[model samples]
Target: MKATLLSGIPLLIMTAIGIALIAQGKSADGRSTLAVGVIIAAVAGSSVIYQIGGWDLRRQSLAHFAIMLVTVLPALLLSGWFPLDSISGYFVVIAAFLAAGLVLWISFYLIFTKVVPRKADSSDAVRMP
Candidate 1:
């Protein structure tokens, strides 16, 4: 619950800013802003899968990436950010998404495994440091 709320803060802020932009006539299409908000929410919410217990890091990361792809790909298409009729355009989008996901996954893996200490298990209790 706490994690969900914390993740939602950015979504709310971005939505407010998008609304402001639309109201000020800075943004041409309100639909585009809406699509962006959806994309942001999807990306933020997908991280929750990574926090689930009992899953190995690889499984969790794959689940997170799949969720992001499923949500964000459609949002991107609906946003009209690229040529919808072009196959190459979709390939580009997919490629970019994969690249970005890889970077984020690696960073999170390093942070959790390297920077954060794990809970001491029974093996640790028996073994000398």
Candidate 2:
């Protein structure tokens, strides 16, 4: 509960900042930064919630790595890191967001897995159902 609440703070702050920036004016650079920040906060927040819900660590780690790759890869590609320069800047940003979303989901999975583990019944019951 405490972890969840704490994680929410960063997300809330990012959301508020994004709203404020939008209200003032839709600056492209600002919007991009805001989007990234919001995404990060969401990932962190969701991770906490997953932990509170009880998940295993190994699985969670795999999930986290998957998500991070998904979220950051597109942006990196769009940034001209890749040989293919066909995609426009806007498209790059779009790809980045998609990746970020995937990353956040993975992050949540990881957090829950790491913090919450399965308990052993310590009993051998072989039944064919």
Candidate 3:
């Protein structure tokens, strides 16, 4: 639930921006922006996979990253945000995508590991004196 809400924030913001763009007469760009936002939100919402029991952190992270990469690559390519005519454009987009993924992964790791408290197991619960 929390993950979904957090993910929706980006979608909401992008929807507003996309609508604005459409109003300004850039319908294609606006629609593409909306599509990208939806894709991002889907990836972000996949964070719930971390909450599933039985999966190790590494497995969960890899699964999530794979989901992000597969979904986002197509979204970006279809959005026309990068040039499609040249090999260099493809390379540049891939590079930027990797850099962004690294930064996001690091930020999420720090936030979840350091900032967010772990779920309190019954054995670790505090008792009244």
Candidate 4:
């Protein structure tokens, strides 16, 4: 669907940028970790607009907040506040990023499903007799 394609563009762009950043060694983690966050956040943010319609600013704002929370989870987890394992180095970093991304995706999906409206179509319109 056109809507689906449109929604996906930002996510794809984010993924490309994340990849570029990782390749340039600007991102904290390598390709996999940064990529997951960028792609997930993009898709999640876009999905809010896709489902709820961009006219509603509140929905869009919530989506942005959701994306932020999702992106931040991994960083929070890896701040050395909690010792989950004896593992260290790249493995720990990657795992933390992936875990955070997954959590964000799940939480956003749940919250958005409740708040975002269903896609509008011709059926929703009333005829002006």
Best by lDDT: 3
How many Å off is the CA of 108 in candidate 2?
17
Per-residue lDDT of candidate 3, residues 17-107 (tens digit):
9899999999988979887787768777887888889999889988887887777876777677788799998888888888988898899
What TM-score does each of the candidates earn?
0.68, 0.41, 0.72, 0.34
> Against the hidden true structure, what lDDT does model 1 obtain?
0.75
Q: Report how far residue 85 has shifted in candidate 2, in Å.
A: 7.4
- Candidate 3's displacement at residue 122, Å, is 1.5
Winner by TM-score: 3
Shift in Å, residue 80, candidate 4: 14
Q: What does candidate 1 score on TM? A: 0.68
Query: Runs in model 1 with CA error above 4 Å?
Result: 28-36, 79-85, 119-129
User: What TM-score would candidate 3 get against the native?
Assistant: 0.72
Q: Predict model 3's lDDT versus the native.
A: 0.84
Candidate 4 Cα lDDT to native: 0.58
Using TM-score, rank the candidates from best to worst.
Answer: 3, 1, 2, 4
Show model 4 residue runs off by greater than 4 Å. Answer: 1-87
The total number of steric clashes, by the backbone 3 Å criterion, in model 1 comes to 0
**What is the per-residue lDDT of model 2 for residues 20-100, given as tens digits with 9 covering 90 to 100?**
777878554445555555446545644543353365666665665555456444434433333454557557656755685
**Relative to the true structure, how large is the alpha-carbon lDDT of every model?**
0.75, 0.56, 0.84, 0.58
Give the Cα error of residue 126 in candidate 4, in Å: 1.7
Worst 10 residues of 1 by lDDT: 2-11
Higher-TM-score candidate of 1 and 3: 3
